[model samples]
Target: MTHGRQGGDGASDPESAGGGASDPEDPDAPTPSDAFGALGGETRLAVVRALDTESPRAFSDLAEATDADTTAGFAYHLRRLTERFVRQREDERYELTDAGRSVARAVAAGTYTASVDRDPVELDEPCPLCDGDGLVAAVADNVTEVGCGDCGGTVLRLSLPPGGYAARDSDEFADAVDAHHRRRIESFDDGVCPECTATVSARIEPAEDEADHGASHRDDEYVPVQTVYECETCGADLRCPVALTLLDHPAVVAFYHDHDRDVRDRPIWNVGSEWRERAVSRDPWCIVVSVRLDGEVLVCYVAGDGRVVDHRRESREEPSARADADDSATGTHTDDSTAVSTDDAETVRANDTAESGPAES
Candidate 1:
């Protein structure tokens, strides 16, 4: 169970890098080994789970939150988790950074998905490998384990869709699939802006689509329309311009290419996490699009192996429960001891996630 590294440098206590403990640190200094090493253990991840779900807590509190005896063993894992982006200490108390939150959320989500599929796989269910969609056999006969470019799950064999053929030897194809899997987070199709209750659409065209005929020269002024997550109650639109910069992220573009290659000819249109994110990136949309007419919120996610996963309705009870529990145990209410600057916290968060927002589940 190796967690992938997509973000910036590994987690390190800024204070111990020959720099003062309180000094703000740069995010690019840590190495991949440093980052992965920090998060490679079960105990470290457990420590992370303890901090992320709970509010900021003192060392003793963290041990309690995890229901682990406050032994030397628990202390060691806590120290290691702090070194990783999974947990950060403030005034000697711990909490989850944004990046840590993302990773924990994904890991927890992946765990659930795995559990859901466990019985089928154990029972030798029909192609439970690809959730029964079937896979295109990989060209390499000896490659026993392959990650699904569509869902991110490991499969015993590559299953191709009907009428689609993969050129196994093509490096380009492999690269394309790798890229897709890397950026595989699920997206919202009906996000209603928190402000505007209306359904947000990512269908805005490039600004250059209707250029001025009289203009002598056209700059690259073709800005993609900004996507807005509408707030149904007040009609305020919230949007992130970066969300529209789809191809800007190499991983995302690669996702488009992979699915297009494997399922291009089929009448069935494949919709996965990558595809959903691409839509979110291109359209002015939300992750949980609101269907005001039905008073429903749409949610989506990516599976471990690259499949687009989805959940529905207004509440994420499971995630909310997990987050709430973590927060309750570790969350500290004090501003002085528990407070963390947004910049420092975000840096910690980004280090763990910079690599895979394109495919975040």
Candidate 2:
């Protein structure tokens, strides 16, 4: 007889199908449809909800909790959910499995509800784009969004957990949502994922569909641009501005800190204009980035191999001999290393020999 086939005598054979019982780790195991079908019946769903309590309930207690008219009907439903949604303890009590608890929570959170009202509240922060004082926080369709009334810019938008809305006041909730986004961006800038610790890569690219996609902020009225970062392992990506990514660098943080400015204190869109890129040389394929801040401009030259070749900072104020002297004394005007000086203009070549350090990646 062929293996896994019936014998000519019609007698059962145990050795044909691997000579053993079915294995849970088999490659051809059943799909998730079986688990989903287990919850299809109303009675089974009711049993799952009844067992989602803090403590396990006895079989009789569960039947009563579900308000089944007869114990036989309740037992039938419980049997259908057993080992899938409902787990039976040694003491003959039933409780929800992790899957069962998740379904129960979804039901309780009104995941299937047809509609929800938007909860709107006023915020105290000003709009970075329009300098307007009309920032509002609202939750609609489970997403929490912060927007400006004057310029119609959607400043911050994020989705919260099912029950996250009722957990805090509006302001606190807004702060929590923004904090989560900030942490994600910072983690991406640092070349890793905050949640999974996976390595990431970043690049600056123009926003798609310029006519449809306005600038980063509403008041800018220019083509939108974005700095995109993607995790090499997880396939997760984040999009922001090139300036924002630069602000997360340690060198930029120290530079602004020395100028009596805290980069973290201001919204990213308000810190500087969007970075402008240009091809400085075609034969050598050199690219440069120009970014304008409050009273100074920064120019960074990058070679074709993607290394930073040079960086220069120019102040709007006139050059001062005393300021230059102090900057040189502090080793800030050195041509070889990454340092900033108070002179009218200071250039630092990537090959400089000063001891401070190279520009941060």
**For model 1, the run of ten residues with the poorest summed lDDT:** 115-124
Report the number of clashing residue pairs per model.
60, 1
Q: Which candidate is the best by lDDT?
A: 2
Instruction: Residues 314-360, candidate 1: write the lDDT tens digits.
Output: 33344345445545665632111112233323333333234543333
Per-residue alpha-carbon lDDT of candidate 2 for residues 1-361, written as tens digits (9 for 90 to 100): 0111234686645443233433347656334566667777777877777776555988877777675678898888888788577888998887888878978987777665533335788777677668798878788876776788889988656665545555576667766655556677778767786645777776545556545655333211223345667655445666754445555555556556667776676543344333454432323333445554565545565433333446666663422343355466864442222122322122323223235544554
Per-candidate TM equals 0.28, 0.53
How well does candidate 1 score on lDDT at residue 15?
Answer: 31
Cand. 1 TM to true fold: 0.28
Model 2: per-residue Cα lDDT at residue 284: 35
